[model samples]
Target chain A: MLANYGYSDGSGDYFITIDTQRCNACGACVMACPSQVLVTVDEDPNDPENDGPVVVAHGDRVRKLRYECDPCKSTANTTMPICVVVCKTFAISHSW
Target chain B: MSVDKQPEFWRWDETNWVNRDIEWINSEYITLGIDIGSVSSQAVIMCDGEIYAYGNMRTGSNSPNSARNALEFALEGATMKESDIHYCIGTGYGRVNVPMADRSVTEIACHARGANFIYGPSVRTVLDVGGQDIKAIRCDEKGKVTNFLMNDKCAAGTGRGMEVLSDLLSVSIGEVGDRSFDIEVEPSPVSSACVVYAKSEATALLRQGLNTNEVLAAYCLAMAQRIWSLLERVGVEPEFAITGGMAKNRGVIDRLCKKVGLEPMKTRWDTQLAGAIGAALFGYSLCRKGKSKRR
Candidate 1:
């Protein structure tokens, strides 16, 4: 399951898509997130049957992603975000 | 802004219902679900997986108070006390603010589960248009979300957008659907998806001599069209269900159904309670699994 954890506002789409199958709850992305936007849960909230730690975007921070991720985007010459770059399994992607 | 002229036209009835058939006091697992939405709040109590009682009311500015009020309202005249509940799950935009909740779940999960319970197991697609956001969810028979998308940043597709129009037109929210249908000819929808632009466009149409109902029809159609595109992105399936404040608006649902080419399944349960009910049901499952209460 590709869980999208952001909202589309007037500005544009701001989402962090987490591929549940590929993510192993490594917490690399969670540590790399500058805004504390990502966290690991004991079970997948969207899938009741799936038990095991999985990374998901923090609920309260979802609506604020456009603002929270702005600093990284504004930094000139910066390529990918730290969260995306730290995911060894390449399970995280951003839609800006 | 002038404050004196209009009544609370957007005010919908705040209500509660108790299932007479369920002997809740004797049930082993009593769980509560509180969904504190942006515009309204709901409380639902389940006894052994069946809905025993529920309450719905407009949300106040303070979310924690709204949660308490909703729960108290539902518990009124019932034999159950707040302390008797085995577990409670909070959901919706204000889920984290529910004072008595043992845990919090996202509205997306709760709505899908609640839709499955209320609309039945066949419902594959759930579209919840709440006060400030739109959620399109694809779920399995068990009500676990498979795919979902949400839009909250824009007011154009939310109930708040409709409320703004209702106030601008001085039309009671309750009468919007019937009045919108009373028009002689359905005008093309206002082109803007932004609420400010739509409001301006609506005002312009009124200046152009279109009646209130005609203008309403245009806005409703536009809202339906916008919602339809969101549903398309999530991919609608059979046995689709619509819930939340917008479900009561025929002006929007009828047009949306027409565009989707499938009639939405009807529910006897109050559509607003779906989130709370799902939260309560989740609490029930958690209790059955012997999960330790957090609170």
Candidate 2:
């Protein structure tokens, strides 16, 4: 089971991580992300139609720091953890 | 007569020089006009019964900067310095920023003047569609603006609307006109009036296997319909002239012609420069009047 890291920032530093291999670019996560953090990389110069969420590095991977994450929920149907309750991919999960 | 009593030739030289200076002052000199519109800015210099120079540049979210750049470009195009400009007039959304302008006139007035200048004084109706707004203005025989209507709230029929559609179709704005000309079938219905919604609708239409030409034609028709509604408010008249950035779009131009039941007159000169030309003409008129008064 993949443990998802939960954000503790009261300033709303939540983020949603997406696995490009699993994402279909069906816009499910884009629609589910309430904070508008999860955007489809539609116009990437290198990869125009890459099915991945735009990521921004805030803190070290191992350390806990204030970071803004995608608000998209993940579903349990796949190996990915769910970020929201209605994720269809089950690719996103929250853990602290 | 004594030689001392004769008028001095040196004094005559000064008098002749003053008279020549007065004559030069009385003669009409060139004037500059600047028009800063939503999508582009233009500058025109009118001298000796012809357009000495004209410059058009994209207005990238800053009207003032665009106007200045256009003015500088026009000056350079004419191979003349800015200090040679006798009078300056400004028109359009950013007209107020023309620092050296003698007066600032409304875009309606400028468009009217420009249209009348090209199509003669009989032109009564003018349609100006720019990047962000659309306007329908009616002018009297003298080229003074009378009744007018405009659409400034939505991006439905403006240049920005076409830009959104162009992006959705993965085509450049320049290609939309020619492609729409080839559309044989009626375009799919586009329900959204907002740009974002319309973009999504366009994407959906593409997914449904609609051809690019058909979709583009549909967008043009939608924009033309909105413009038609605005024109209806002003009451279309004969000798209608269309001017602005979007006037170059043959798709919209042809649609407007069919809807209005009259062919529009478009000049070879830059359509976006209409406002600037009008301002320059107005400046020339003011200078002429001032000179007559001083006489």
Candidate 3:
């Protein structure tokens, strides 16, 4: 139940990847996130196609992350956003 | 340089320094947190885990200077030198800009810890409406962040929006909250969501013969509603507490609490100093951890 959101602009390709199957929805990433870009949603509690509850980016933030997430990239300790680091399940990834 | 010539609009006098009733010389492990924010800065000094002294001041053009000045203000009345502090951690929008900080932590982490300290361990939710942004955070009993949401890109639901309205009505920013309640009836929220549009609409309302209090009531209502939407997205729970500058606005706080149907936890501590206090607490914990690790 992996989901991808966002698009490529003139600067680069930006995308936030969520692997629902691996996600436990502990929401540590959401808290670690400085910009509050991610949110948790209950797709369907008992549905087979969807994994109960998973974190996803807002429709509005998908585009804004291209600029919003840039601060995470500036530091040497982090190449990816802090959300990816705090996501213990390794369910979320970013493409830039 | 003439105080009489200055406009009262968009300006409010903030308490520059505060301290707990205690003797600092008796405590060990002194740590500090300098929070250099968009519109203001705070420096909090802690002995062990208890607050010793703090300073809250308006931020100047230079971030490092703001951080230093805040620390100096706090230390002015206290018997401590800059070199006597064990560690300095910076938090807020300008966290990394604090040249004197030994390290830095994000505002999210700092706010959660600060809220826990002020409101007790029961606090699970924190809503901070700062100068240029708003944050809704959910944390655990231990004061570690679990989930959070922020509205930083926009001016609405922030202190800047209230400042704009104050300037428009030619009233002191501090009086806007109290004046909102002076209206005969509760006014419906303004239609425009953007601060710029809302400001113009408020001006037009005045032109239509509505009084300043009425226009202010309308804006306050709108602000409460706007913040309510953001809080809804994150989901609200009991034991909620609010931080940052907007928490002082009685109108917004009362309206927000009524709409959410929950009483936000109260505190005697200054709400704006939450971030810096949290940072100082972090420094305190870190120092203890390091000492234990060495042993």
True contacts kept of each: 0.57, 0.00, 0.00
lDDT of 2 at B250: 89
Please list the residue runs of candidate 2 whose C-alpha ends up more than 4 Å from where it truly belongs after superposition.
A1-96, B1-27, B291-295
iRMS for all predictions?
A: 2.2, 26.5, 12.5
Clashes of 1: 0
Q: What does DockQ come to for candidate 2?
A: 0.01
Q: Which structure among the candidates has the greatest lDDT?
A: 1
Candidate 2, residues B159-218, lDDT tens digits: the string is 877877776676777767788979667774466445657678777777888888878887
All candidates' TM-scores?
0.89, 0.66, 0.77
- CAPRI-style quality class for the chain A–B interface of candidate 2: incorrect
**What is the model-wide C-alpha lDDT for candidate 1?**
0.88
Deviation in Å, model 1, residue A48 alpha carbon: 5.8
How well does candidate 1 score on lDDT at residue B42? 97
Q: For residues B1-295, write the lDDT of model 3, one tens digit per residue.
A: 6667758588766565545476666777888899998988999999888888888888899998999999998887777778878888898888889988887777877888899999999998889989887777777798876666555656676788888888888988888889999988887778744676767889888888889998988888888888887677557877999999999898788888899999988999999999999998888887886732211
Stretches > 4 Å off in candidate 3: A1-63, A66-96, B1-4, B18-21, B291-295
- Model 1, span B174-259: residue lDDT tens: 99988999988889988865677767988999999999999999999999988987788678999899999999999999999999
Best of the two (2, 3) by TM-score: 3
